[model samples]
Each structure stands twice: as C-alpha cells, then as structure tokens.
Target: MTTIATPTTLYDPPPSFALVSPFLYRSSVPTSSHLPYLVPLHLKTLLSLGPELPSKALQQWCELQNVRLVHLGRKRDVVGEASTWKPVQEELVKEGLQVLLSRENAPCLVVDPSGVHEVGILIGCLRKLQRWTLSAIFAEYASLAGSQSRDIEEQFIELFDTDLVVIPPLENRIDGVRDVVNDPPLLAPPQ
Candidate 1:
C-alpha cells in the first residue's frame, strides 16, 4: 500500500511564485519550509538560474522527490568582485528554453534567487516566441516585477532573437507550445 504524505501546516508558496504555463512555473528560490507546498505540483524538473549554489537541503529534497535539478548558471567565487558580475548569457537562456520546451521536463519549476530579473527576462522572451505583443509582454513583466523591473532586462527581451530558439520536435514538445508550433500566426498577425 502507498502512503500519502500530509502537510502539517498551511501551504506557503515561495516568494513571487506564479504559473508560466500548464506545465511550467516560476518562482524565487524555495526554502525547506516551502517544500511541502510543492508536493501538489508533481514537478519533474527544477531549472535553476543565477550564479548562487542551491542549498544542501534543496538538493536532498529533490533527491527524495525524484526531481531533476538542472543548474545553468556558473558559480561565482566568494572572493570574486561583484562589479565584474555579468548578466545571464543568451546561450544559457536558450538552453533553458530548450529544457522548458521538452515534454519530458514538463511540470518544471524555473527559479532564481529573486525571481524578478532573470526569470522575468526568460518569460518575456518566451512570450515573444509565442507571438505575444511587446506591450502585453512588458505588462506581464511589470505586474510581477513591481518596482524592481529593469530597463536593461526589457531591452534584452526586445532584442532577443526568437529565431535562435530551436523548438523540440513534435513528439518531444510540451502541450502548451504544440498548438503554437502547429498554427503559427499568418501575415496579418493577431489583432
């Protein structure tokens, strides 16, 4: 017989948690206290962005839950100069997009330390790929970002070349993007 795990307290999601799609979610770095709330999501993968290393506790939780954690950012040395830190690279974001588009990685959580800049930029680029208007994309970004939004991130999203994003083949594609891939916008475009 299988035993179901019951939560001892109310569900408390991580800071800035929100759904990106049916199978994709975005949020700030989750703490041990937030682990219980993640149970219902049945996450298959955790795509971590930014330069910081995940806590040992998070690693253990992922191991126990059978969730694959993929960290794309390079680690910053403790003694490294903060002024030398660079913005997230395009190559890494493209790789992350590929991970998100794969059906096998569905029910994935894309997280960063703050979930304001990195995650927001990624989601904005995704919206562009989905043919969403720039205004709409920026609106969504601003809604979550509040006062923390940056013009540089928005510029990156605007300049992002969706042509470079290689979508997975039909069989490997996620349900959310399947329709988008099949029925692309015509010359007239959506009003």
Candidate 2:
C-alpha cells in the first residue's frame, strides 16, 4: 500500500491581526507562538504602542529577523489610576503615521497589548487623514474593537485634525500615499 504525505500549516497570526493597508498591519502583542506567523510578512519594521516596553525576547526576535523595532509608549505620570489613563497623544500618533507612510517602513506591523484602543485610535486617525467619513471610520473601529471600544477614543478620532498630519514627499512615501496627497476633499463654499 502507498501512503500520501500531508502538508502542515505554519501560519498562526496574533490575536486581532488585521491589515490596515497593503503594507501595514495591526495586532495585539505577539507571544512566542505567534512569532512564527510573522515570518511570512517579511516585515521591515514593528511599531509597538502602549505604556510598556517590549519583552527582551521580542526585541531579540526582531534583531534576528532583521526587523527594526520601534516603541512609541510612555509611562503614565500618575500610575495605578486606571481612570487617569490618557488617550494616545496626537503627536505620537502623527509620528507613527509618518513611519507607516515611509516606503522604507513598508510591510510594518503596529501592535499594542490589547490591540484595541491604541491601535484603533491610530487607525481611526489614519482613516481621517485618508479622508474617510466619520461614520465609516467609527463603523470600522467598532467592528475591530467590539465592546472594548471607548467613547473617548471615538471622540479623539472625531476631533483629530488631519491637516496637522505632515506627509513626506511623493517619492519617499508608499504608492497609495499619493491618493490622499493629490486629491483634496471637496468643500462647499461658506454660505
């Protein structure tokens, strides 16, 4: 009797993993098991958010994989106060956006511990910068974040100023960057 060989699956994506665009992905903090799933992404950079530094093992993994690891988290001034946890800073989000926009950082992953609020907020702002309507933005956020979504985060996205997000020159940016830069949203003249 002849036996056939079976193929095994290798990819096991981290919790809440989703593609933000052709090159950008968002997910929760990847554990050791999830690391293998990341191999196929060929990520050039991993942008971590939240108030905690990445685990040493994760840093080592990034180094071994030849991926640049960037952490944009800062400890809270008033610790131990859950209510005092502030929203991700606008400036910080803008800086993260700049990183994602760069062609050099293509195929990047943005991760936070829960992969809900901070990542949601960043993506929401990006949608605004990309000229998405507020309803559509909230719908996407709600879908990804589920019940974990916060009104404050939604408020932040509503109030975010897209004009303040500085875009790199066309040549330095990823291919889709020009879609937002070349076409300005139409505005009705002041009555």
Candidate 3:
C-alpha cells in the first residue's frame, strides 16, 4: 500500500539486453556538447543490487549533464492515469517482469524477477523489515486490512505473485485497477 514520490529521472531499456550498459557503469550520450555519460532516459530500473548503492549519485550525474531521469516506480503509477496498467498487470503475471519495459510508463520502471514474490504472516513488521534484508516487504495495517481490502489484495496476488509489504497508500478513494490499494485501512501500519 506504499506509494512513492521521487525525482523525475527514469531509465529506458534498449532492444538488446546484451548491449545495454551495466546500470552503474558509465557510457557517453551524444548531445550538443560532449558528455562522458548520462543517467538513463527511461522510468524504471530493477537491479540485482539494493537501493542503497550509488544509483542516486548516478542519477545526479545525468542531471548535471542535462539528462533527465523519470522515475518508474516500484510504488508509483505507470502513468498519471490509473487505467493504463490494468491489462499490463495481467500480462505481468503471465510473463513476469520483462514486459515492464514496453508499457506506457517506459523508461521509468525496472524490477528484479528473482525471489520477488513471497508471503508470510508477521505481526511486528516494521522492525522486521527494518532489521532484515529481505528482497520484498509485507505487513498489516494495525488490525489487518479490512474485508474489502483483504479481498482486493487476494485478487491482486492471484493476478501477480509477490511479497506483501504494506506501506498504506491512503484511505478510501476509488481509483481504477489498483483502486483497492489507494484506500488504506483506517489505521496505517504503525511503529
């Protein structure tokens, strides 16, 4: 249920995976002046590495060089509108994450397919996630999600297998596709 707002820098995947540069590695981008490298021009990035690595630095370098990185979210919308991602999610369940590159939110999204899906019931999750280095996150918001939310979450998991990490987006608003998630429980996940 977590939603993220980030600096607008995104990375676009190219046609060939072999030809793509290592995300942390530097390569020149052609422009009016000679720049040794630029941040990725796409929206999402999935990495074998954790978020604490030098990705923020790399993004900044790109900005300095006049490259803009539009952030594709792990928790943000694919497009400004909520409608674009419904079919995409179904395709994601069928094909896994490789299909993310071709979506309307291209150049801004990335994901790791390895062990990305897991679910287990844990009561005190904030401490657990904070202390443990898990690939994904999950938790309940206080007494657990309401019946409607629980059902919606089950539907989501049926469509896509993934670990449940509850960040509690907001409470009671009807958006499409993931409208269920936008309205968090009356209680947010507490510390």
- List of clashing residue pairs for candidate 1: none
- Model 1 Cα lDDT, one tens digit per residue, 5-102: 99677988999999998979999999998998898999999988868778999989999999999987663322444354335567767888888888
lDDT of 3 by residue, 1-191 (tens): 99898958444432112212122211112232322212334324322111123255555655564433432233223344456433223322322222221233233222222112211111112223233223232233212222322433333443342334332222321111121444445577788
Model 1: per-residue Cα lDDT at residue 81: 40
Worst 10 residues of 2 by lDDT: 75-84
What TM-scores do the predictions have? 0.83, 0.84, 0.20
Worst 10 residues of 1 by lDDT: 75-84
lDDT of 2 by residue, 1-191 (tens): 99998868767899999999998999999988899999989999999887788888899999999999988876332355446434767666887888888899988999999999888998898887777889999999999999898989999899987777778777788755544556454565678
Instruction: Point out the higher-scoring one by TM-score: 2 or 3.
Output: 2
Candidate 1 colliding pairs, count? 0
Candidate 2 global lDDT? 0.84
